[model samples]
Target: MTETYDIILRNGRVMDPETGLDRVCDVAISAHKIARVGHFEGSAAREIDATGLIVAPGFLDLHAHGQSVAADRMQAFDGVTTTLELEVGALPVAGWYERQATLPRALNYGTAAAWIFARKVAFGAIELDADVHPIDQMGAGSEDMCWSTEAADSQQTDEIVSLVRQGLDEGAIGIGLPNGYAPGAGVKEMADICDLAFQYGTPTFTHIAYLSNIDPKSSVDSYVRLIGLAGATGAHMHICHLNSTSLMDIERVVELVSKAQEQNLPITTEAYPYGTGATVVSAGFFMEPDFVRRTGSNYSNIELIRNHHRFTGREDMRRAREASPTDLVMWHFLDVDANDEHRRLLDLSVTYPGGSIASDAMPWINEDGSIYEGLEWPLPDQLSAHPRSSGTFTRFLREHVRERRTMSLMDALAKCTILPGKVIESCAPQIAKKVRLQEGCDADIVVFDLETVTDRAEFNAMNRPSEGVRQLLVNGQFVIVDGELETGAAPGQPIRREMP
Candidate 1:
């Protein structure tokens, strides 16, 4: 009798980004790994007929912030197999990991050492709370902006570095430097963190310190600082959310990064296929007096997600921020749908050579201004969140690969899979088994129809999930089948580095 695999995905157009393989084939899964990939005459307890579907390695999201069961469900529709919190990660990394281990999850998850949270703790501003996610900490410094705008004294800097090192030692995949949130962090502080990362031979996921189109501490200056740190410390510097941060000056900044890459500096970039971005309304940069002028956006561009309220002036925005500093707001940096120039600027970042695609997805919140952490299926339609949380990956495939045809499907898949996996594999060895469809690799895969796959969630109706994922498997367990989510499935596993 032939050996029967656990599950078999047969007769699908199997596309492996790493091998450039795009042909009809069968993929066998057993023991949470790919057992075989070819015309294998194998029997399986469950077989998914994937005719006319694209079978590929599930996407790796290196910047996801939505870390709950609700967020995982939405991301599953977007074809994400692994979602990591690497931009602004968790503090007390061990506690964070411990907390996650106890919860049932749908997709694989991991976090980096959070620099912002370390500074908050070192500065004696807030207590470490494993339940309060890093996203909630964004505006927690609103009372004085101390964590966001105060330079750490030598003693405090030392303490901060020590905290970050502890997180890494506790198996954080990398370091999350949300420098933009704490612009007050001097060059020396950044260098110290980068040096620690170098010692560990890990990457520093960074949101550069500034975000303006012009000089005198502009986005260009920030990129220069990040690149300098990588060159000086010999650490990998991963730039997060390149599109929204660069705004209209993407061409100039991309040029600078390109030149740095040419010189072989350790740098990588990621961008979501959107013109707008979402963050706390009271973020550090929004408080700048020249914020509207620098970003070429006004108060009207910032809309509170809970109620769709747009501020009319600085005072209006300030009042809202002061009332509820942690409220999520949509910042429309570019009118991509209305302006051709804005669309092109966005394309520059999204389609950059060798760049990866990341969602930077936010968490789900109820209309009453509380986080929706309930384990509910078919998430409440009244819940609010950035559309990108549910649509990012599919949107990229729809616009770039199917609609525009600006790039081939294989290259696009690389952005979603292999490129992201390569970004952190140097530090997180477990990722080596992911992002591939060949034998011996982890069976983290997705099947979808190219023609019908599209993002249904928009700004007006943000709760709708994307529509293309036919089947999704994480660790060889089906979380989604026949375009439906398996509500009871809890197959997620932690993707962390081994502790010493």
Candidate 2:
């Protein structure tokens, strides 16, 4: 009897990072699971001639923030199937999940419990609204920067913990402690957060507390504090954006992290390929008097995306931030193209053994500097965002594997797929069935021509999606086929931590 499949990918270089299986084979999908791998004489309702293409598990982004239909479509072209908001996650987890359930999504989405947002609610600084992402409302508390700069008293700390616990109880994937966003959060509070993560058997995703290259609250100092917390609480601590946060002092910072991992302290890290990072212009660190000295970059490196305006100096940057504190800005921490040293610094983080490749992708915005919430296809021409949002996975493949050969095809795929999946699978067991090309895994796959797979999105034209994805499937449904987006398909599912 011939087995039947819903879809069949024939004669593709099927690569599974988990089992190191890289060879020409057929992949059969049926009922949202990979039905078979190897020779398939079976007929399918839809058949894709995948000759000369790479068939692998779709990439997983653990630090994604572009959680809209438009954003997901752009990422679909880049071969991503699962995007998790593990860093700076959402408050009121159940409400956020409920809101997302009503939207049409192109890729799987999930979020962690946001410590900072919980703080805002606990301090009576902001109202709870699941529809409002933290990035959109971060500036509302910027009047005094109290949420980022004030220590919570005993009662406030209790309230904050209670709110965060409620989110966890509601099945948030983990705890998100973006310490850099709130540097004044006391060690006691952080320790409490780590303890909760340990109790829940989940990881804590963090952006370290500081970013200065020099001491007295340097990146090194921050790493030490984070390592101590992990050790003291016996919790898994995952560092976000190792490249941008380490600045020029990545060597020292990586060494400290390496030693901690050597001692088996459960410290993990992720890095994006690009040196520039996107964030709110009014970030607390940007307001520091020695911001330029600390980051080793001048005001010109901070570019407002809406008008492409580069600040001439600190005052100019301050003026723009004061006017619209929540506006998105790109911070060019390293010029990888012009400087060999800067490029090497980025490579150190990106190629770090055991580190995953995550896109800390920002949301798209309109000309008015508002987040684009409409379910528009191809995105609006005037919409702007960091190129990393759309191109991180494809760009990594083109440069690291195909072009420079800095990483092997199999290794790079692991960084994008299995490595990231394993990071969160402990808490979100549903992810265990993803990020594999084996039979019985969820049928989330990407087929692309390796030779031509590259990012089209550049700094100047940030909205362009990547090229050369022949087919993309999420849960046995095609979001993109034959290099064109299926504008009507929305097969995305929620990836949440299982509740008791």
Candidate 3:
């Protein structure tokens, strides 16, 4: 007789991008693995009637930055089961992983070894603080500014490479290069990091060196350089947030990436669904005088995330940049007309073949400039954050797949799940089993009402959780049940790359 399973999801429209399975089926779970994927005669301790719901592999976010309990709760509500800080990764990778392991999390977590943080350590710009990750201390007035502004010499570069090696040895998923944040990092330094990734058979997740469309070093130039490095070193290169980085030039950027893939150089890119991009006002991105011309926007296009105040002129920008450099600001670059070229450009990135979807999520900060931590979730109304932190995946389903019909449901799910899974599995073997609904796979799943699933979080009220995600399971345990979050469930495990 078939043994009774721990849990069973019955009569759901199961979607598996990998096997191309989309049909009504019963998924049985026992312990942490999916036990079956068809009709089940045995009874279960718990059973969910999932009729008219879509059950797919939980969403995976490769560019998440909010690595806290509050952030995880928000992500779980959005149907994400795994989130990584691959863009601006962590420093002292081992410590970061250890610290997170001690906390209760609602979703799986991991990070790449951060080249920016490693460089800061080598330059003696940031001291190793066991209690705090270097990224937590980054502010305009902090010592991190030196690493972002000052070019590294040969000795310093070698030390940075050594630190990255140590992190890789400590089980980092890959290497993170936020070159745009560190403008002083030269081409040689960037190439060396790629070489390190190649040596370990891991990918380099990068926020490219330039964001502007204007020359001398345009966004196109940056992609060409990275593609060249990938071709030269055989390193898998994953570009972050193509829509924000490429702006209106995403078409040409996608063309270049496609061409590189055609030549068999392993390269991938991801984009969030929103039209606006968020970042700190004090970063090097806003320091250039040509920022207006390059981004095709002026002072009015910049709005403070904290207070929603628009930067009226150069003085307003200067005051914000100087007084509160770490404050979040939104750049309304893609918020154009519906039929405008900008919207088309944004759509192209989202619908690009095999391109993964990632949320470059920011953390929710309180009125006292503190981040919400340790199960203090459902952030207060006064706290501010980018909506992408809570809504990227849901928004993609609603706008692109449902409303515009730009992307089919299967293709969209593939982008959010299998595509990202393959990208990370190339480096982290631990995640190879995730992002697919199959027998013997980890039972990370999401059940939602397709007709009603949508993101409700807007810029001002960014903490509002997404609606219609009826249930979310991490490692076969429900973190969200019936549209409500289960605060005590901490079934999330760490995703790490095993050293060869």
Clashing pairs in 1: none
Task: List residue ranges in candidate 1 displaced over 4 A.
Answer: none
Q: Residue pairs in steric clash, candidate 2?
A: none
lDDT of 1 by residue, 278-388 (tens): 999888788788987887888899899999998898888889889998899999899999999999999999999999999999999998766788988889989999999
Give a tens-digit lDDT track for model 3, residues 287-355: 677888886778798888778899887777878767776677888888746647778888888888889
* RMSD, one per candidate, in order: 0.9, 1.0, 1.7
Rank by lDDT (best first): 1, 2, 3
Supply the global lDDT for candidate 1.
0.92
Cα distance off (Å), candidate 2, residue 33: 0.7
Clashes of each: 0, 0, 0
Q: Tell me the deviation in Å of residue 316 in model 3.
A: 3.3
Backbone clash total for model 2 is 0
The estimated TM-scores of all candidates read 0.99, 0.99, 0.96
Q: Single out the weakest 10-residue window by summed lDDT for candidate 3.
A: 134-143
RMSD of 1: 0.9
Better TM-score candidate (2, 3):
2
Best by lDDT: 1
